[model samples]
Target: MPEVQRIVFAGTPDFAARPLQQLLDAGVRPVAVYTQPDRPAGRGRQASASPVKQTAVAAGLPVFQPPHFRDQTSLDELQALQPDLMIVVAYGLLLPTAVLTTPRLGCINVHASLLPRWRGAAPIQRALEAGDTESGVTLMQMDAGLDTGPMIAERRLPLPATMTGGELHDALAELGAQLLLETLPDIEQKLAAARPQPDTGVTYAHKLSKQEGQLDWQQSAQALANRVRAFNPWPVCWFEWQGKPVRVWSAQADSAEATRPGTVRRSDERLYIATGDGWLELLQVQPAGKKAMPVADWLRGSGQALQSGEVLT
Candidate 1:
């Protein structure tokens, strides 16, 4: 395989940042790094740099934050770098043909899925939500279509029955970085003979929205439990209680006698709520504007006088 020279890196989040760090660790320096513009984040809504930008800045590499690259000016700037290869991961923008063809060896993407499956924005969360048994990363040669690229290499990991989206995301990020390091040496050859993605088993992982977190008690307990895991640490699974929103941080489901869904049933200190088919026990929760606490803690403190018959919305 020929040595890659003057590579351009494009990415935005922590997933992308890890691989760039790994490349740096391996003494591979990028000619330029491209990341999204700083955006407001946290409770204060302060403008913050993306993880990729942070890594690039810390490494003293030049960074670009073009809102889009379709314009000729942006295209010109990218061309000036004279990249041999472009590595993209969660870059959050589509690369036009001009930009794609600019690199000598072409643009290669480190996608967070075994392509032809979970081929869009929220692959990790979608896999967990669907109760998939396995998950993996795919290194591919970029094409115009969404994740519709010829794959070069892939690495897999088994999905635990109760894995959370956050857990899977972190694990996959590291796994992707490791895979990138191992695959880089053979990248040129792999690209020359990249395999086309199969049309079967192709699924789109739609981007998650805050509205999806609103829990629907009519859904089966197992389904809700899966969603609870998939939406954690984001728009956390929630339901209204006493006209206020209550976020469920952790929970488990149990098969039980049929009852009105959303009815609260107490057994000692445990808080179990009836679902369409079973009971979902709330392990941890956050009442609107309050810090998350164990259900037992909330029951003993703020909910000491509350009885079992109330229904959650």
Candidate 2:
């Protein structure tokens, strides 16, 4: 009989892939992996591989891409595996109470944020959007409520003011993987205890909305920069240039004095837009479905000239 833990891992995205890979590298081959079914993607609407699915496949492990967890037959299959414990990381599906209790050691979760703080879908982005000073991964015991579980471990990370959502996502992913690796021995020994989430403060990191990417120049420059960082690599921050939409990849709050919010202020070969608080300098941008280019390159190709007093909205 194999002495390694009989584990079932559940997750779907890149954030989940890190821990899955770590477990495999540590020679803790999961008994099975359950991820979200592949979904139609791209212009052709082809079924695309999920990050977790790809990692599971690369590791030569059994992969289950189920659409739902409610079917008793599917539940029975998981139970038959007799998993010692289930490790779930952003699996996207809610594990029914029955399945949660089925595992011999119950389930452990690797949440991206310190629990009871930023608990929900988009913790990393939410932290950047809120201008949070720090964020971390919380290892928790699964419960019925959304991330309303007792924490087994936690590791904090300081938030950088200039970091984009994508960067923070990568950072948390690595941190989460390490935290999970650290918590495993205790989990096997049944020495881990579930501590209730604090009741004093609770905030939900709601899922990202596509509309949030639509840049509103009326907002403050700092606020707009936050939006640019928060929505990156998803619903990218964008606004119209000569009636054409351009996505802004990177930018900084312009340190100059402001006149009217949204007015274009060109400073030292850079494009700046006045906002309620200050000005913002456009660093990287894509012109209406074209490749994202540095702000300087976009300047050379434009027909209409960017000038002060022209509102960017």
Candidate 3:
């Protein structure tokens, strides 16, 4: 395999940033870095650079932020780079065919799923929500269709029954970086042997929405528990309590006597909520405008006392 020259990296978030850093550490600096334009973020809503842009700036690499490639000038700017290879990871923008073919070796992507499955946005969270036995990263040769590319290489990690979305995300990010470094040495050979994805198991993981976090007590306890774990550290799963939304950070499903779904039940100091199939034990929670705390702590704090049979609609 010939050595890759003039690699151009395109990514935006921390997941993408890790692999970029690893590449630099391995003495393979890209000619240029492409990231999404700074966008308003945080409670202050200030325009902030993406994690990838920050890494590039700190390393003194030239950075480019184009709103999109719809304009001819954007395409022209990239064409000028004459990249031998383009490594795209979570860049959050669709690349036109012109951009895809601009690189001599064509573009490749680091996607956070097994591929042929969970082929769209929000793969990490979707995998957790679906309770898949395993999840992994796939490096693919990019195509115009969404995440529909021939596979170059892949790395898998088993999903623990208790793993939350945040935990799985961190694990996959590191795994992806390691996979990229391993593949770079043999990338040319791997690309030549790339295999097309199977069509029978295709599944799309739609982007998450805040509304999806609203806990539905009518669902089985195991399903609700999965939802809570998947949505944590983002749109945390919540349910109405005393005219306010109380976010559940951690929970577990337990077998129990049947009761009306959404009914609050207390056993000694522990807190449990009735679900369609069983009981969901609330391990950690955050009251509105309050820091997350254990259910025991929340029970002892200054808040309205939860009645034994009070419904948490």
Candidate 4:
């Protein structure tokens, strides 16, 4: 067996943690880990640890949290690691040419979507939001351009109609780990080859915003269902209910509502909202700070039934 190389790992969210753990389990020694700085999160607005930081700590690795990678001190500190290779996954930060060229093997990224399509942040969410039938992960070299690196490896995953962003995220995370391990030997031996992405078929996946999560009841239930799945864990799909916010967790298409868009109609054991061509069934929902509940339970608990002519924004 060949000797292991010194790796400097960079990533921030849970999507990046799995492959980092895989590299460690594969006997590659990481000199240092880089992740985003902790910021306020959750209901109390407390500073929270990033998933990558937690994983690195549990693995007993040195961790570096930097607000950005532009200053002289941080660059010097990272260069001091003397890494043979840098493995980056969902790091959520752009790497300058100096940092990119620091490692002997250069920096490799684990992107959630296949290259040339959905080539930016929030790829998984954007794919689902756009109603794509399939999405896959691709491993590539890191360039100054966003996800424009040359590809070293690729693996495809099915995007089932029932898959939520959280579910797809976990599936891809596991698949990405396996792919990384398989590619390492080739990379170490200088046998791995990369192909440049084509100019055609390129699309940028902009980051998800709070506004994108708002449900427009006028759309077909199928469209709303996709939104419900795409935004499950963050900026969740929601609508207004008598001027209050109600987050939708799961939804399905129906065809029985006779009222206008945003009209909340009820049937036994179900809640239906009308659309231009179909109706949407709200399976689960969260009312503000309260826990998620079945629509039936929510309707009963609130001591109020959703009535017609109510506009949800």
Best candidate, TM-score: 3
For residues 165-226, write the lDDT of model 2, one tens digit per residue.
Answer: 99999999999999888878667543355678899779999998887888887788888898
Best prediction by lDDT: 3
The lDDT for every candidate, in the order shown, is 0.90, 0.86, 0.91, 0.85
Clashes of each: 0, 1, 0, 0
Candidate 3 lDDT score at position 221:
94
Candidates ranked, most accurate by lDDT first: 3, 1, 2, 4
lDDT of 1 by residue, 198-219 (tens): 9899999999999999999888
Q: Which portions of model 2 show Cα errors greater than 4 Å?
A: 1-4, 188-192
Which clashing pairs does model 3 show?
A: none
Q: Which residue segments of model 1 deviate by more than 4 Å?
A: none
Task: State the TM-score for model 1.
Answer: 0.96
Q: Candidate 2 at residue 49, lDDT?
A: 88
Which stretch of 10 consecutive residues in model 4 shows the poorest summed lDDT? 303-312
lDDT score, candidate 3, position 301 = 77
lDDT score for residue 198 of model 1: 96
lDDT tens per residue, model 3, 134-224: 9999999999999999999999999998899889888999999999999988788889999999988899999999999998889989999
Residue-level lDDT for 9 in candidate 4: 92
